[model samples]
Target: MKLTRPLLILLAIVVLAGGYFYFADSSDDSGQSNLLVSVKEGPLLVTIHASGELQAKRSEKIKGPDGLRSVGLYRVTIEDLIPEGTVVKEGDYVASLDKTELDEKIKESQTEIDKIETQLDQIRIDTAIEMRGLRDQLINLKFSLEDKKLSMELSKYEPQAIQKQAQLDMEKSEREYAQLENKLILTREKSIAKVGEIDASYRQQEHKLNRLLGFQKKMTIMAPKDGMVIYIRNWNGKRGPGSQISGWDATVAELPDLSEMMTMAYINEVDISKVMPGQNARITVDAFPGKEFQGLVVTKANIGEQIRNYDTKVFEVIVILQEQDSLLRPAMTTGISITVDSIGTCLQIPLEAIQSDSLSFVFKKTRTGFIKQEVVTGPSTDIDISIALGLSKNDMVSLNAPSHADDLEFVYLDQDEKRQMIQELENALTRRIKAQQVIARSVKQENLQSKDTGGSTFIIF
Candidate 1:
């Protein structure tokens, strides 16, 4: 048994056969799958998907100015979210503050006014009493002067000495009368001036107090124009506007006109250069579907703001809607796609179809498998990439291909081997069919005008 060459040869043959079968099966399982596609001539649109918000084209926020007095002691509670899309008219009561505190303020001011009035009345009375005393003194002095004059006349007939004494007495009486008259006149003028000063002071104080009181009375918030109410959310872990009296950081509410709407979006700095004013855009709101609103780029921010962990700077862009709807509200989140550039009837391919290292190529499906064909590519939009060379109209190509094929050793299949490749071919055929369907559907669905440049059928497996 140890020296049997026949037995050794038989074992050797069995091992060889087993090895061949094992290799064959393994190759079959690891073979590339087929991808099917039909190349059709059509227009491709490149779009940039940007998220933004639906907003009024012209909207103003009516905010309560800081330090506006409250109407009552009861504070305003701004908890309710106004019903969405409710139309309002001018002078409508959007929100109101309690008036109790304002009332108390008014009363206090009134009390102050009353106190000033009382002081003024007392001053006037004192001036009148002084004036009356001056008048009585003047009358007594006049009567004494008249008696002295009469005495002088009678003494003139008696003696020259008596006449002289009478004359001196009359002179003293006349001087007294004149002094009393001057004093009365001066007292009356002083009294009148005092009363005028008091009255002027009271009026000034009253005017100032009244103005303040009037402002307090207007503390009841009212809408300046017809619009819808939108409540702004508070940020930085703080309550929304009108939450506290911590000195005037309140957002109370906003009245936004429904007729005008605009979408505000932030675009990354890398792509901001592609955006400009007057570019057409399509907008979709999360609240609505199958409804696309038309808009135009109205503004592009010159500056950038950091966003996310990448700290990428983004520029703000505003898109104005052509038509406004009642459903449109301020700050509603929206998805906006700005058409930075659109080429009608341009040759394009799916972004996934192109593979690049130092050069780019697309996989052209064949009966056996896929063959790599080099392509000259052009600018890429969000979805499709422009193919400038090495591809013709209606040239069928694979959407996605394996990345490691460049490193694999090339293998050529004979007729028999190719016949055995039915499974792979069928899979490729199925994929090609689906790809064709997709292309056709896309053309019809997108209303794309397509023309066949070449006769090439794509098989996706």
Candidate 2:
């Protein structure tokens, strides 16, 4: 049974050829299987999906009182806050601000006020005593004047020289009495004025102390309305230790009305125009899977804003929930699918069926194999796309490339194709946007130059 050397070499060549042909045929079969897909007529719903967080449309923000608005007391820090997500009633304690500083200020002011009041009382008493002493001196002066006059009259009966001396002495006493009376009146008026000044000072300090006490009372923040509490980011722009809530910047907790809720989503700038108010939407919370809610687009931002930590700009779209759920809470992640357009019947195929670079086309099955057919596409959903022309309900199309087809090739364009379409639209939009920006800048510059020129002319004139 042993074979010769030439026969052995021939046998090896035959085995290698057989293995090559078997693999080649197997690959061709696998490729053919990838090509076969059916094109059918069905309903196509064009939708735009966006992810965002839930929030209340109207929230009652509870912040610390704008503090004292005085030097070193313009802001207050939150010392205690009710647990987040706690349901609170109106007038319930929401937060308490640090009262140490304000309390100390009030104490100092009260002490100063009390000291001033005591000084005022003593001043009033001293003024009264001084007035009484002045009155007594005045009475004494009047009596002495009367006695001198009587003596002068008695001397008039005895001797002319003595009577003349008595009269002169009485005139001197009259002058002294008049001067004493005037002095007593002036002293009384001066004492009254002094007491009034001290009393005014006391009143001013008392009012200041009362104002400080009022600030102390304002340190405790109460819920203005019944709602659930949601803790807010602190002054340091975060919510952990070392972060403190402040009244100066209005950083505090939010009391959001749970009855009305909405999800705030950022739509890509390219898709912003497609989203409109009043469009219906279906929403699902990531935390509560299998639970769905309905909503409508209530608002779309007229201007686009850049998302933090991202370079692309996005428009904020508000979707109001039509039904309220007890499990739904603010800040929960939401998956929103908005129905922008829908059609009753249309010739559609899987999104994978379409192939394009500059032109759009799909591979149509033929009796021989498969052939390329140009297509006109309309609105598309996440999976299937609507063909407006060049397709029929019974037509069979390849979702991928066939083994024998040369023009058709399988291209992985699952999400990439959608992004490409958006990119192309964005490019067109960017060009138009740039043109508008240029014109706007030109107008602004012209206005500014005109103002400057007018000012110069006025100065020259």
The Cα error of candidate 2 at residue 327, in Å, is 2.3
Could you give candidate 1's per-residue lDDT for residues 1-461 as a string of tens digits?
Answer: 76698899999999998754533222222565434344445565556778876654445554553455432233444433345455668887665554455566677767777877998889888977888888878777788888999999889797888888999999999988888888888888888888788788788768756765775544556677887766543323222434542223334556666686777788888888766665678999888888889987766667797655436878877777887677767777899998765545657777778777665777765444456777656557766787655567766677666445664333233445444444554564466446534542442111211111112222111
Q: Which candidate's lDDT is highest?
A: 2
In terms of TM-score, the best-performing candidate is 2
lDDT of each: 0.63, 0.72
Candidate 1: regions farther than 4 A off: 1-42, 58-92, 98-101, 147-173, 205-217, 221-228, 232-260, 301-315, 323-326, 349-376, 390-461
Predicted structure 1, TM vs. truth: 0.60
- Poorest 10 consecutive residues of model 2 by lDDT? 452-461
**Model 2 agreement with the true structure over 168-236: per-residue lDDT tens digits:** 999998998888888878987887888788878888877778777777777788998888888664213
Q: Give candidate 2 misplaced runs (Cα > 4 Å).
A: 1-36, 57-73, 87-94, 118-187, 190-194, 214-228, 232-256, 394-461
Compared with the true structure, the alpha-carbon lDDT of candidate 2 equals: 0.72
Error of 1 at 303 (Å): 5.8
CA RMSD per model (angstroms):
16.2, 14.1
